[model samples]
Target: MHGRLAKSFKMFVLVALCMSLTLGVLSGLAMAQEKKVIRCFVQAYTPRERMEADRWDPPQYYWKLEQEYEKLHPDIDIQFLKPIVGEYEAWFVTQMTGGTAPEILWRQLGAAKADYVKDWYLDFTPYLEKPNPYVEGNDYWKDIFIPAVSESAVAPDGKTYVLGVDIVGVGIYYNKNMFAEAGVTIPSTWKEFMDIQEKIESAGCTPTSFPLGGAMSNPGSWSVRLLQDMMLDSKMMEIKTGVKGAKGVVKRTREQGGSISWMELVRAIKLGIYSAKDPQWQEQWKLLKEWSRYWQKGFLAAEDTDAYRLYITGKAGMLYDGSWQVKPTEVDSLREFDFGLFNFPKVTEESSPYATGIECPSIGGAGCAAGNFCVPLVVKERGLADETIDWLMFVTAPQNLIPLCNDLGSFAPALKVTEGVDPRLLPFIKQLERGSERIQPDLSILTPQYYQQHYRILQQYIGGRLTMDEATDKLQREMEKGADTLIDQHPEWGLKK
Candidate 1:
């Protein structure tokens, strides 16, 4: 009987060992599966409110990214969590400070500029030289992407924390068909542009159309478009620094660049950039008045989409929108009419060799680091971060860009003619290339403290808070205090020497 009991005990031990091994294998597999799935909070871009579709899903653009990437990487499944959209600064402070931030996520650019505009996000420096395997060292991208684009996306310290996925070049859109209707030619200089605007207005059509609701066409965007044209020839910023006609670029009223401030507008380019009694101060104010007079009575209150609708439906003659504005219309009635374009004409005697572009295209109508996704250095996983980088390279590959353009008529990659693109857009892209393609940063680029102050200055200029002189002078003081280092890091730009 004792021998029989011993045999049973041995059998029990064997069975228990087998079960333990089985459970161990299963647990390992489960952990591996968990690791393979990447959970990222794509801080919601296509606001649920703004979606052009009836569905509650994320934008087709994000789905399009996931579908293609999954085909290449079948082993990994990406789950995108959508964060609610609200005031980015407040939300970021709550989420990040609250310690519930996503493991993998896009840094809110507006919030980043407002709060943590520093090195905390993520650095893709080591990744760029060894960019995504599919597009590492792609010659087309290297050539097609202008240096200024990198200038805008990268901090002066040489780290890429953001990207401009779709570039915005604010050019003049005159209907060749409309010019034919009006019997006027496209202007070549700022002077000629004013004359053209006057003529277009005289013809009883809206000369230029834009909107300034909450923050759309405020002082920064409006000022830069004109400033981009002005800084090309003679600059008045030198008056602040005691220098001559300013050279190179200057942000925040040019005085930051050692360029004179409060100086008289050069007489030569009076038509394009200097129409007021004072070019430095009154120029912007005068232009705003001119813009106000040229637009419809209720234009200042129009939504951006409404503004575009006005232009597309033949109600407005000239529309000054960035490149994204030129696109496939959602409404069928608006898509038929063909629009023509020209870069805003030079305001100086000699047009800038490098004409700056006003590029802040929508990533769902608010600030998104659209073309940018940062991978923190501390992600520490060997292959996961690379996987994300590789995927980014795949989607933004110049070849892949054709589908994005065709799928939604959304963005025009700065290429002449990639396969499957509508030939009609080729000339427009070429014209954008001809225009100075510098990336123009908005007030967000300055210290967060300056946002209200800057807006106030613009309001003062527009709503008469300060005369142009008072506004410009006030701007110089605020800029010197806020963004001197950030702007000065790139010297030879006409800032304090």
Candidate 2:
């Protein structure tokens, strides 16, 4: 009787242990399903903006992220809200400032960041101080990202607000067929670059094409590409290298280090004339009327889209564009034409590197969040802030860089990667890797008023409205006036002239 009772007791104990294990499994699954969600908002893309839902469709770049986020946490959702056509800034101001905030919102960290950082954004130090138990040490917070990314996101009080997922700037895109046809070895100096354009035109084809608008064409894109010229000639780019938000008005390469004063460059600016009637060239300017006379008939009337089609059609020899010009592999002409790329030619020495013509990334205004992100201080107050931080680190992980670059169809930033990127990009990337680097901005980031003033002055100079002396004086005066306002508003920006 005693043996039987002992055996029965042992069986009961085993049954109880099995039931406990099964319940534990069910509980774990339940917890997995209980993950959190963050709603995000962004401004419309320029391509999308230009088309305004007429012909172009929204890109599915964020689709992959949405799916991945959902998979990781069954309970979490990332519903992206894109602002209306041309009303992005207006809508964001209305909705965000109106107290209808997104859980995990993002925007450019420009002048607005300086304004928003005080009250608009969150402080991530609490989450960053310690590692999440589920994940390994927070290497991304400590050291993985490029210093520039960290600088834009970090506050003076030691809080991390936003992480730059990528860098956006324009570079010169060329045609391999055109290069071969011209019999010109890849030009290293600014003169060589121009000579190629002249050769292409001489061969009865356009040397290059770009988009220009308003009363005139603005060469901001051109300037940023050649900024490295100033970087190599000057110490500015090197000084600000890897450091975010460094006060930079102008940086020149060693060859350019005061070689061509702003005044000198202004004088030479008229020398590189583009023809406005060559609508074949989107960025065609009227200041160079003689250059306009050189183009073939019917070239002046072409719109930006038409010009792009012509280049892709291979009728035009070379196109001066950015990664944006290269559509996906599905686009027939883009796939067919093997495009070559070079840094925009420098203003002075060919050997001297190019400095991009654009400036001041991370400004908080304009409302377009694509290629940029901003985290409001409101999100930090939530319990799920940890997850929000995780999302950023994951999004910026080097693994995602290739996919993002492939989607964007331009050059990728100089981040450490496992394998190689697109071959067409290899040459440009190699140059950037070896030489000095600077981040240039596209039109979306620039202050329209400021840009207009600069444009009018440049137009006047090129059109002979302002002499070189007058142009320099205007630039200096404007810079000083603007500098005082900028300095007073954000002393941290180091905008002192």
Candidate 3:
């Protein structure tokens, strides 16, 4: 009778243990079901393994922020979606139209151009004015970011629609060993810059891997745009206010920087200040043609990757690229030479009489940044908008931003969070502060239709297929038509009846 009782007691103990384990599993499942899901599409910041290229060391820090946020908010689940494949613009449009967009997406205000006006994106103005709970001593959400970048987030409609977490700037990435071999140093003026390139070419290396044609027209076009802005520096205030001696026009401030209003751009175009027929405009193209002599052979057809290959192989002395190149270029295993970056040299009177001697400001502005997250208007219906924004605020807080920026090693952080930032990004940060708004806006973006024609005309002129007179005539006609179409479309600008 004693043996039977002991055996029965052991059986009861095992049954109770099994029941406890089952109950624990059920509780976990219930918690998961109760948690709210916030879908995110982080573009390049998506985890490397999700993108299926996981060989790189030092995992993406975005995941760390996601995990930390989850730990803090047990009731919420952050679901980072895979990076979108194919053309981003088309894919984004489809998602929005289908009402299937992630709650949070990597998009800038200018991504779709019409999305803001169509009310597809949420207006963030109200939220920006509020303090971020995650940030200590945060008087307002906007105050924590770099002043210029923060201010620039406001769209022309006077509303913030995107949160730019990091800023990007462009500079010349040079092969340091090649520069040493050529006995040249960084150039401060356009004349000196040209001379250095000549010396580098004399040393039997391609001076620059500048692509102007095919799918990579930005580098070549950017050079022209910078020079044009430099030439027009003296006319900035006049163009900005639409009058030569306009007073009390309230010069818009951007921290230590400045920017032209969209209305002012329309006024300038209507007043013919931005006419392509102007001699200054023609001179910019001439300067581009002159600079083309130092570019790698077949620059007109070279792809961006081709330019990168040339520079990395040490056959080219310099490559004009953005801050984004620092990551892959620095980590490349096959690169044998060290590299350094310097701002594009200033255009001075020596290069052209039209040059105002006012150096071209950095091309990047508030609108120009990476990790720019935007929320879809549809997220409100899905009951995820609040949680989505909360996550954005958490990640953008300086404490989290520092690690992400350091790990990305590409863009400069939009916030004032500089502690522990990657040392390679220091130069970019210094230059970004010195950069003011461009006096001349990029016409291609402001007027998309004319840009295609403009690119073609530039290619013809630069490749020796069209004369300066021919190119300028075609460009003038296209520019005038483009301006008219833009004015007509925006009745609020008062440029059209």
lDDT of 1 by residue, 37-61 (tens): 5556544233233457532233346
Candidate 2 per-residue lDDT over residues 275-369, each given as its tens digit: 11112111212223323333334543344565566667676665554455544322543446677555554444332233233321211111112
Q: Give the TM-score of candidate 3.
A: 0.89
Which of candidates 1 and 2 reaches a greater lDDT? 1
Regions more than 4 Å wrong, model 3 = 1-30, 50-59, 112-114, 243-258, 437-445
What C-alpha RMSD separates each model from the true structure?
Answer: 8.1, 11.0, 3.7
Q: lDDT values of the candidates?
A: 0.50, 0.47, 0.76
What TM-score, computed on C-alpha atoms, does each candidate reach? 0.67, 0.64, 0.89
Better of 2 and 3 by lDDT: 3
Backbone collision tally, model 1: 15
User: Which candidate do you rate higher for TM-score, 1 or 2?
Assistant: 1
